[model samples]
Target chain A: MNMSISEIEHEIIEEFGVFENWVDKYDYLIDLGKSIPKINPIYKTDENTISGCQSQVWLHAKCENSVIVFTADSDAIMTKGIVALLIRVLSNQKPEKILDAKLDFIAKIGLEEQLSQTRATGLSSMIKQMKIYAFAFKEKL
Target chain B: MSNKNNIQSLFPILKSSVNNNKLVYLDNAATTQKPNSVIAEINKFYLKENSNIHRGVHHLSQVATKKYENSRLVTQNFINARHSHEIIFTKGTTDSINLLASSFGQLLKKGDEIIISEMEHHSNMVPWQMCCERSGAKLKIIPCNKIGELDLDMFNQLISNKTKIVSVTHISNSLGTINPIRKIIEISHQKNVQVIIDGAQAAAHVKLDMQKLDADFYCFSAHKLYGPTGVGVLYGKENLLNLLPPYQGGGEMIKDVSLLKTTYADLPHKFEAGTPNIAGVIAFKKSLDFITETGLGNIKTHEDKLLDYATEKLNSIKGLKIIGTSSDKSAIISFIIQDIHHYDLGLLLDKMGVAIRTGHHCTQPIMKKFKISGTSRISFAYYNTIEEIDHLILAINKAIKMLS
Candidate 1:
């Protein structure tokens, strides 16, 4: 609950220095996806599926000590990587805090302008699903 | 003999020095490039004869109406339909399917069943899904084999007395498997079930004879057949269409509007409401003309060669896997390389000026059956040559090397 979001952002940016073009930036994003721990297979089922995505993605999150910790996986590797990036940015936070989080992290990472409309939509849907979880968790809290 | 040199010359895209580079367009499955003659006909419509059809008293309107009606007759002849009245102009194949589903689907009872195949595109599948959901009717699927061919025995076993509608694709866009539509129709008709054939993929490559096939409803998109977008044809037997209620209520589809009772227009007009895609409908004739000029047989021969050449080249690459190998396929070849993602491969291929379709191709059910996330598809048209296939092969080889 006391985690510094900006500190994590600074570390990510510092770890992968600013690149010349979007191509280099995408490699960094892909690397960001690779760094996250893989989601467990048991949590992946029909209940956790996203409707609009072309791939089968599953996400599981639990609140421990008032901190939201999330785990996600996908049948698609890149999509799994995408979910990992999403989990890094969105998870392990309170419901209100997660709901108020800025989605401009995509632009900060240089993916907003670089990714195609289809890929952007997929990312947007993942964010929406996370928000849905936040809203559901908010009521219980 | 049709020389390869002359055949290449026929396609202006191959010859035109655009941006000082030869355009290697491989997105033929999406929509094909139009010939100069077709372009001129469209231009002539806007320049010389441009007016509203059916309701106009002016000379230009008369010409436009004549052309529009003539296009219908031409399309009817092309598909060998019983009458021009059966050909209803729609926005696209999606619109045609939606219209049928909304109207005929409303007639289905709670326990009634509708059958579809696994190889259907989303347009064919989604409408039926919605239809069954709305009507409380059960939906059944005829499973496709690993080779992407339909299991005919499974199809026959699925047919029962409670089955009200049976819809299937004439050809698989992702697999290029040409289905046995006639046999399916016969099987469905035996149980008094109506058959709707989604001809979106088949219309471009194979010839259609609606009467011979005896399908109750046949739908296709004009854009898929080298014609303009925003226009398609829905062919239904006269009696069946009459039996089904009107889909949309609007102008031109009404016989009389009254406070007490309203009567609908007859035949195709009842299905077609309001002002249709006039320009797209008019230009579609030229596309059909182009096909007639080149001949469907000639077009099929050209595309088959390209498919063969591309398949052989792609197969030679190490670690590459080809999906959907049916003996009776058209011109679609879908594949993926081991350990390399399809999207990554597509991005690399595009940089080399080769366009290909990547991902599920709106056939998620088929993707689920294959147990893979997705595959990269290279679909061919009549104008495509072996040289482009070679370029595709080279680009794919380079892409795989970059990833590995």
Candidate 2:
């Protein structure tokens, strides 16, 4: 079954359980991070550094035979995972399609508001980075 | 040992877990976790003693005002200021430094110079940059050595009659370099230059007596010192603060409010501007109490041990290069692994329940100096243990293996 953002978020929220304890919350975050697709090491380079993030991130995308493929990595685990999720949702899709995709799709997963402000900002930077990459790739194509 | 147990007891954050692994919090330079006593003090203020400070004449207000003033006294004592009036409440170190820049910067003439160091946090650097840009003053940088320590010889060469201010950080957030501030202050004094120290990273671990340091001004955030985020201390010499115009014109900072003729309040109140972070300020004292009670010497010792332990372990790993290997480091270990991006390393470490800081650390110039984009930083606090260092070493090795 193909899982939508909402479905995945719901599953995560349900499985993540309570935040009465900080440990549980961190576990849920790490688990969520681990679920993202791992970016290949070859793509990690100077071209993908996002300004304002405490972690170093490299995002690489290509319109390989008209199927957009994104490869990314970060020095942070949660950020890495977050980028993975972004790639899953945005990568291998038409630049215009991905560009027009609503960011609310993330919130619908119930995961958007749940992250810390720093984490949220990091995710936003990643999304912005991806979109920039998409624009560059589209122009090249 | 007494200090260790007391400090551990105060901060329950030490006992917490991160992810599935034991939490190894090594990002102390960013901000420290609040102790239970401080947290309780904050809650108590909110729960029972909630009231507007200073202006209010009600019972609760009196209590709050008293408490707030008491906190001011505590801060004044902490920094060893001559008078509590020298201690102005601020949002944080950033706000206080900005306030000075905005007011005092307006007076700086063209060709004037404000000397800063290579190791300042963005909070300390940006305001001076803006001040120089606005006033046509020159921004002179005191360069750091390859080891990340400030070049005192370069500093001597840079400071001249034109040098109006020489601002620097007491302890670098990214490099963990502990600057020789007394010498810096002495040299600046010789040039008759005002000195503003960014003590945000130093306040918790360093012994700071403003009179002894002889700094014209000192700024530090409460959050970095295990206190609340919204309150900070700005200890300015009375003579200097009085000469500089108020940063923001508003209520509580003025005596008579007429658009035609507004007379400003005296000393600290003149700079305060508006209703301060009352609760945060009052509760902040408890954090100071926790720190004072712990004794900076003991804290330094504990943290040094942790830093040495972590450095030894991390250095042992192959292909690992420790960044900012200054002779004088304050519990911060910033490093990079060859053939692996800091992003990958940070992510893997988090999975292992280790929280570290990564990236350029807001000092792009320093990063450019090193010819690297960023490094992974694991800053230590007194609460962090040797065992946490062990965990971090293991995690780093594992992450390297996984990524490579």
Candidate 3:
């Protein structure tokens, strides 16, 4: 059976809770970043890019079998790692479900600072874009 | 204990911690941490002498006016300007440049050229570009070579009869390359072209003498020199200041007003239109006193040592490339690793309680010249210690290892 959005978020929080220090937490993030599949270069266009970030981030989303899948990339590995965590929580879910998801796991995992608009990572923008995609897909249905 | 310890102790923020670790602030170029004296002076202003300056006949007004004017005098002596009246209070370096551009652009005509270097901060560049757009004038750039030094030979050629002004930074904020302003002034003056020196980066690092430099105008922000924000100085030649139109017309800047016509005030006052940052300006004097008591020469010597030491240590790291390699530099280093991005490095460093600036350093043109997006930069002030540098190196190494 497919897990709910909160279930996935809970799973992530539990996985991150194992780390004792910031270094280990960041190390795990870096590993998650490395494990994420490479996004297609074809989808990496200026239209897909997000501004207001120190590092360049390209986010692309498409609906498959009424489920949304998010693909994203960043020049900075730390940002890429954060993006990986976000995509893992939001992707492979229904568009309506994705749109309704609160995704509070970011704050629970102590990554709330990255959600600040002023942060260089632009993780907040990435999350916003994911929801925007869900909303657009939801409208079509 | 060394005098450095005493100086560091004066800044209470230096003793603070971040993220469960000691905060090693290396972002002095953005803004220096305030000292106890400057902070106290600001507090004392609000507590004792809080009033609008230059207008009221009340006793508090006179006291506020005197303190504000006294700060201008302190700034005049700080930079060794010709007269106190020549020093106009501004918001900061960017505001000073914008004022100059708006007023000075009035003198320009079609086809008139304004020369600037590639390494100018956006503060210096954007204002001139706006002025050029307004006046139908052309902007000329003095190219920076691979090593981040301005091509002086090309600078000589860029100057022409059409060139009205040549503006350059005293010390580059991103690269830390110290431009030869004396030579630039001499060259521009011979051609009857006025020069404006952006002394924002140099004010804290160098001893400025406006007479010796003979630059027509010099601008610097007080915040960079351990003073409060929202306060800066624009020092212009007295006669030249008299010629340009007032930047803004308001209560303090006017001599007399009638229904028919209005006349402006004298040099300094004519430019300081509205009620200025009274508390910040008054507090700035204490910062000047702090710098004077500590000694600029001693600060320079200490910072130079830190720069050299940090440079040596940073060079040893594998895959790290320093962007600015100029022999003459302030206590700043901008570098990028082979694989690790600056954003990643900066985030990890912050987690370890190290604060360093990352990205374009507001000189996107310099980044473009180098064909890179941005760099991780660390700038040092007098209060920074060698131990802090070691900590920064350790943090960087750990961050790199994790990323790898």
Worst 10 residues of 2 chain B by lDDT: B1-10
> Which structure among the candidates has the greatest lDDT?
3
DockQ, candidate 3, vs. native dimer: 0.81
> fnat, candidate 3?
0.77
Model 2 C-alpha lDDT per residue in residues B266-339, reported as the tens digit of each score: 98899888788888999899988988987899889888888887788888999998888887889888898887
lDDT winner, 2 or 3: 3
lDDT of 3 by residue, B1-404 (tens): 28678888999999888999989999999999999999999999999999999878999999999999999999899889989998999999999999999998888889999999999999999999999999999999999899899999999999999999999999999998999999999999999999999999999988888989899999999899999999998999999999999888788888999988989998889999988999999999998998888788988999999999999999999999999999899988999999988988998899999999999989999999999999999999999999999999999999888989
Candidate that beats the other on DockQ, 2 or 3, i.e. the better one: 3
Report how far residue B89 has shifted in candidate 1, in Å.
0.6
DockQ for every model comes to: 0.20, 0.29, 0.81
> Between 1 and 3, whose DockQ is larger?
3
Give every collision pair in model 3. none
* Tens digit per residue, CA lDDT, model 2, A51-102: 4455546777778876578877665655665666667667777776666666
lDDT of 1 at B189: 90
Evaluate fnat for each of the predicted models and list the values in order: 0.14, 0.45, 0.77
Local accuracy by lDDT, each model = 0.80, 0.81, 0.91
